[model samples]
Target: MKRMTTLWSYLLTLLLAVTVSAAQESSAQSLLRSEAPTSLRADKTLSGFGYADRNETKFNYIGTKKDLGSFLSEYIKLPDVGVNKITKISFPANKADAGNSYIIILSEDGNETLYQQKCSIIEGINEIELTKPFVTESGKRYLVGFATKPLGIDDKDFAVLPFDYGSDIEGTSYYASSIVPYPSEDNDTFTLKSPKGLGSACIFVTLEEETRLQTLAYIINVSGTFDPAETGKDITTRFTVRNIGVTDITSFDLTYQFGTGEVKTIPYSLKTKLKSGKTGYYAFDIPAEGDALGAVHFAVAKVNGETNFFANRCLDLPFRIGDTEANAIPRETVLIERFTAEWCTFCPGADPFVNAAVKSLSDAGLRVSYVGHHLDDPFAQPESSQISSYFQGNGIPAMAINRVPQGQTSLLMHPSNFQAAYWTSKLLAEKRGVRIDKIEQTITGDKLQVVVSGVAFQRTFDPENLYLTVILTEDNVAAIKQVNGGANYKHDALPRLFLTDALGDLLSPAADGSFTMTLEGTLDAKWKREQCKVVAFAHDNLKSSLMSRRNVYTAESTYLGVSLANEPVALGQAPVVSAEDGYLSIVGDVDCFELYDMSGALVTTTVWTRLDPGVYVIRIFSNLRAYTSKVIVR
Candidate 1:
């Protein structure tokens, strides 16, 4: 059996490698936020970098200064936020030359000059720097390129050739002109070519959202309800705090209120810094009001006392502990990313199983967030290939269940396996004591307005930094040609647009005051507006790889909602729940359950009295999960 022993050893080694890889995935996610600013490429609204159209024009002649250096220049429409500074300009050239004079001029949509700077170029592919920076307001356009003197060298590339990229859409070519001095001439003799609707320069500039700070708070988990029998005693309930911010959370003042009672303030000056995207907890032994049992309790926050980060900032949540039946729901969100391509015949086999699992999870009250990333598919997006980079695979039909168990991409296409992955993810998420609450979306004209809110439930847990991504996905493309599924593929949850950064908008502790955000979306005509959905999530971006791809945050994570062992547990599954004879009883997980009237009023007393009840809703809970049931008392 020596051969058998060797095979067993090999299997064990493979298992060990898979385990190590899985563990490294989550820790690796923090790399995105940890990367240096200079190393990561900045996100720009308008980039001439993608050389989609290769209409290369050779430099013929350089005109006099009065003509504004017209040998070669690529004018582009600046983003709505306009241009800040043309940091670096890379121009591909045909040949090398020393001290060739060059100039970069900015104008308003092929209009008069707004800003102009002339410099010298070297050889082929030169990165020219502007002597004086140019800045302009939103809704502006500018021409950015180096106008050079006649090099006299034939068949050579020159300045402003196109930023080394291809097939990616960015901007368009406005006009190309050849004239003795053309601001005076207005005829066909001046216009040479225009790659209208399908052109962009080899330029890159900072966008609008790039400047705003992305620090905010998420209320993860709020647990435990008020009890009346523990009269004159300190009744306890706890909530979690997750610091999803850029900087550390050092100090803050918190205000707590139980139901409609008097407000109590608890302020703390901490010795240790609470880093970003980490979870923490707070427990309160609120003095029992004995009689005022069914009122709502919550916490309101005022952040680190920084005015710039504090304004328009708020984080508040009101929840019931063993009180309201409606407040006991703590469902988890499962992110499922499937990697496939039309070329892979077996890829279609996985989709049916995965989608069926999603339905089962939904029916069970679990939120399943799913997306299919196309690899080598005709409908593939650049971001789809980027999504594949998160998981390890060389073949098709691979799936990532919340970025867990990496190196396990192959094998198994069954609904039960899908359910297992989803439920396991849900369980892990619930264990983290995190919760996403209150998502509001409104579509006005072309702009879709959205607001998202959340909170933490365990002890404070964050890494070096954190960011939150809000996504809008459209369902069922309807006409996609599928090789295996059918002629038409009902694509499930295809990502259409990102309200924030694909990498994610930064979140900070200052947002703890209310931990809410508002985003406006300008809908694309390609997306079916009626079938669109919104998904938002937060993660540690400190060690993230988003730096390389301009901060496009990939939700295909391996470890989400890190488990918090010491935190409270779900009370819904408590076995000792019983209600009989017009009296509702709750013990271990809950002290008691309260009955609400038809007008949404609490009608209860501890005198053990019989109710003249018709029907009522009973709300019960601790901190984790809750269940509400209807009962008729006669």
Candidate 2:
């Protein structure tokens, strides 16, 4: 009886030990997860930095410019000090048929090759799983690098990695271009013997382990249909959210804070199951009150009752509330950016088509403005190249309408679709209360001065995010070696100069929602003053998915040197300009006024009565019109 009892106790102890071991094995988890992205923005563009050539190899590291410095061999210090396995690599490429590429991982000191693998390249996003996963060590930093080679077809076939110029990383990207390919697993050398340049090529690695069952969400886009809110009315905003996690998103919460107001959290329950890698639209409403000008920003606060920093995306929504009537016609203007080149065979045919489209819009009682950008041609400028890359104008004879997001249409498209695209955007474009009230253009000697004033028909909510972009375009200029068209072909609306940054310059408006800016640029000797026109437009850096990379609210164009002083003046219609009691008052419905000296130099965009007793040109600008008259201060 004693021996049987002992045997039963031993069997029970063994069974308990086996159960505990199984529980421990279940607790140690492994899940597929991606590292933090080099750029968090949804949009990326093809960079004109350089093109890959046959027999040429380029090595690059995606990181801040400060850390990369002038050296080609730069390493990113691994932030996490734990056991993690890198199983896959992903990146973006400009060309679909790139020949060969490789992903390399170097040791902390950059003297040893930890892991390397050859990856097949594709046009958009390319994902490659490694043959053998690299296990990371604790307290050891690793540097990730990529090497690429061009197709052997021709020298300039336009093959390179798509770059993200707007990355929020610490420093600029670093690269080394070499005539010969670097040997694989060469730990003897730490630096490359090639010319170096700046370019960002983002690469995301897939880790095999992190926290258990990670949940991530990416905010894809926001709606652009949010109109100006009426005072005391609730304004609704909608955004598209995607489940980028391994697990399904059952519920989530979004938080928004308008200006200095209190942050409000709104919870959302997924009626339909949002599986991994799927997207859904959610809407929320907030009361529009108390603030006149401020930004409304939203973020993903929590997912499934847990949160991570990567879940929230930065989205800027500029809001406005009007004190006027609830329903008002939005001041609409169509902005066209035409991409062309002298060597393009089909580009000349696109000119008349665009003009016809513009004329048709004008006939329909719509204002249309356009600017031509030359690509890889003699007339191409740095600003033109920059703008082209930002908009991803990969091909010639492309046009963008109003910069509003099209469902699947690119920001730049073929000329054949310009009319249809324009109409599509016009029909769905959000109504903006902003308008260009007045524009003043003056040419003195070798310089051109422009003043653009704007006003909101309703109260504005965000003024700081409001921006204005001014461009000087020349008309009827002789084409430089036209390819399809004859030598007599004249280029119209060719971009001559950008008075502001290619994107725009921020605006600071008055309390009454009135703003003004004065821009001056040196006139090129080759440019004809009479053929030049100044184009100014108001746009906001609104972080909405429906809006393109940028959206133009309203745009206005005026011919240079064609001020009211050059035309026949009507009595009483002109603004009454007078200088009295140390105050310069222009009694009229003028939105803004500027003072210019007799020499055609701009003095001020504000009312200034401190001028000495002398003859001055007072230019007053109103909605859809401008007036110029000579005034004397005694």
Candidate 3:
């Protein structure tokens, strides 16, 4: 019995020693297993990983053989770290590793005393199902395990699970839908683990009814006075386009037709897109040919291969050729006597009648001259007032025939009838012996000097006080105001300028029957030379008697061959520059010439008359022509 008792004691001691050794061996195995360092951390919840305090419960972890045993003695703190937001998560299908399972653990501290419950991972992404969700007070920590076992099999070969729990939590919930292996019945279930912020929403819609082109047409018309002598005048016509449809019309081209053969195409380049309701205007000018009526038509062509025509609008303009007959007809000078005022209302009624009478007489080979005396005519010139004062007419609508009072007459017919009779009577008498023979005019710059030399058979007027007066007048003046019938009214051919004294000038009729005089004056540059006319008459200073008058003159008032100083003539086209040998020729008329460098400074004035072989800028003014063109000046 003593020997058996001793043997039992020995067996019990050996058994206890073996149990202790096994526990120590298991502890050694747990320590030897690969694990994240104490510095590593993660968050199992949507709140991502970051540094955790050393004392935080979520930071503590344990590694031991027992189901939940502590291995490390002290709590380990993890440094701050972060994981990128997950864009997508993908897994493989039905492969050898498809049925793998994993265990995930998380901790904020490295102490072996504190650890969260393990999470089971399925074949695909197996979101953690939290009984008590892992809350992150400071940072986060996690551990993952992947294992696989077939049905009814105990052998397990766990695949290495990537420790990317921090990556699973995305800041934006709008992550791409992932493709992963099909989950089995045992491990397919998953939870969001923690709530994440919602993503932004988006919406889209379609547009309806695009813009379309509608009917477009160009219409042109010319309406103005026509004269035979002025053939190159420009007649302006207005063009307008209207949008006729409900939709907006965009770009369109306009083709203009002038007469039968002349055609021009104008393109409309619009900066802004036209809306549904809009209209545009185009003003074009057509040059007037001599004695011909011209018509213009417009057609619209759209960008989208569409064309439209509005009605055919035609213009009938009358033009005349040759000189006016009114100027050639024998003129019976009729003295127009009239009294006028600015404040009189009744004077306007008689103005038109007088004007009509003058026009009629003029058309019928008669020359009518008028002296308008005004008491308060607002637009009356100082000269007109002076004439009225010299006549010494009392009351309004008073008149004088050739500066002589024709008895006080209220009738408007008095001036017209008396003046005509007086002129006819004087012409029929034919008692004057002196007659104008010759008159000549020459222009130098802006100065006009006229030389008048004539022969006289009889010298009856006073030689010392005989005065000569030159009058310049223009035809076709519109919108002129005058006084008639005790009122002020508007008329035309109201004398523009009277260059003479009350008793004109002295002309000594020589015993040799010859006389000569020179008249010089400056004319306004803006005056049209073509329409200008010069009239010279003789008057006596003593008796204030008329001697002789003449209306023959020359000098183009419309086309001044020489332009004003510093106001160069604008060229209507670009000049072509040609070089042959060492000489250069510029073949165009330009307003000015200039040469500039790349820095845009005026280098020199290019003299067309003298230039070395080089290129230059020939600047011409006029909208119908180019402003500047490159010309080779050699």
Candidate 4:
């Protein structure tokens, strides 16, 4: 009797310990929730991305090409489905892994492997329905993923499938290590990781955009130059607001952060409904904070009474509140980099405009730089792709004017008025106080050395505030083909190496506004050694400012900043561009000019036409190069 009682007590204690441990683990895991519930709703599929193009039909793998026995995963917050009714788990399969994949469910912490669907070949998306489904709880994030079975040395187990780590569905991809007990689900341990950059698993989850009563608001952009004033003094600054949602609203909350790390929110109550797609100007009359060199400002917009997504899309702006007394010079050289590809159909037209913009700006005799980043094609190497990816653009014809992605001509906007755009951006960036001197590059054998120095005139380039970035680009790579189907294409200013990081590098910020740095790199055999040029720039890490002047390879100016002078500014008698009334009249000396719709499709136009009110990119070309502009035909 004594022995029986002792055994029973031991069993009960063991059961209680397991229950408590499970509860603790569950609590720890629930922390992995997504900020948005769009993908956790019932009856809605979370496959590929929310975009139709990213469904199972498309195949772009996330991990190393298509290696089987490897893991491809996404962190998903599974919604509550009643009594084990959430039966289906589906994902696109690259034809190779048609019948040999293990569907898996991992714990939130990704420390334990909970369940596995063995031989769960995703025949088609939603084709393999679960007979006895694994139950999921609401508000709990889980890893819903798949791992391919390793083939017997001779076979390839991995194949292409849908994956998108960028765009609206950003929180989806999570990296997972090799599942323990490789071919078996019996092993209960694995690690979950966040993908690098926007990440690379070609995966998406289907979720409703609205979980309950959620509406998204975006703080489109804030643009204005601050006036000369002292810190601690109140200055009235106005910003433009846009209603991006379908429903009109009456009130909005604007938040801007001060240099002192204080965040201030201003409320704007409107008398009239600010309809969707409409923009209105709003102001915040508040006292300025921080010193004369300038205080970096971050601004965000949110709808009243709603926790919308606008808060995440805030803008960081560094502007001086007072006169330019401390700073004496502007940014010396502005680099205009256009992220383009031969596969981009819109690039042909965009190239002319971009080059023309450079031409127009350089015509003023300003020290402007241009690099055409040929990407997504054979003409450009992987380093060029890295430079393109650093900016994280979703579309082509992306331009990073001045190494720092600030100012007007960024990838977000169309390449319409390259000339005016570059010039305007140059003027704005040139006002900064920094100078680069004694820039020299020595290429010995396969090793290259770049030595340069910088001096900040107005403020300090301290480690807390600044970093350095170096890039190498080559001219005349000799284009093999073109996206517009033209054989006569010449690729120029292609990036061969990022001497520093693709984005930037950490440097000891100068105490007295002066600094020097040395960078070394190995030349790739495939790269044209003699044609390469070094491009270096100084940047303010804290304020996100690109010093107006940079140290660049000074050997050759392809455009010579003098291309426009040889040709007449007019086509026989017509002005380069002019607008009167509702019609925009554009004419130039060229064989032919083309107009394109925003979609990049070619459209027929008659130079001057009575058209609908909208934005348009007009490309006027001459034998030397093309001039582009965004004309608002109102």
Best by TM-score: 2
Model 4 residue 409 CA deviation (Å) reads 11
Instruction: Name the weakest run of 10 consecutive residues (lDDT summed) in model 1.
Output: 557-566
Model 3: number of clashes?
28
lDDT of 3 by residue, 105-222 (tens): 2243211212233333332223334344322232343221112222111112112212221111211100001111123211112111111111100000011211221333323223
Q: Could you give candidate 4's per-residue lDDT for residues 1-634 as a string of tens digits?
A: 0112232233222222322222233321211111112222234333322221222233333222233234435544332222333345555443345455566666665556677765544423433444466665554555555665432232222232344333222234322245333444321223334433332333333333323222334554465444445667766666656543445667877777755456788777888876543456776676766554434454455675565544655654545555554555644346677777777778777777777666555444344556677665776656666555345455776666554434332333356744485456646454655566535566677887776666656442222345566677776676667767477676767777777765567656356766677888888877765565555566554223333312121211221111111122344543366556756665556555555433222344565566555444455666756555545554
The candidate 4 region of ten consecutive residues with least summed lDDT is 557-566
Which scores greater on TM-score, model 1 or model 4? 4
Q: Rank the candidates by lDDT, best first.
A: 2, 4, 1, 3
Each candidate's root-mean-square deviation in Å?
A: 20.3, 19.7, 45.8, 21.2
Query: Against the unseen true structure, what C-alpha lDDT does each candidate score?
Result: 0.44, 0.58, 0.36, 0.49
Measured on C-alpha atoms, candidate 2 has an lDDT of 0.58
Whichever of 3 and 4 has more TM-score, that candidate is 4
Q: 39-145, model 1: which lDDT tens digit per residue?
A: 12223122222122222322211111212233434443443333455555554444344655444444544445555555655433355555555555555545555
Q: Clash totals for all models, in order?
A: 73, 6, 28, 24
lDDT of 3 at 511: 77
- Of 2 and 4, the candidate ahead on lDDT is 2
Candidate 4, residue 270: the lDDT equals: 83
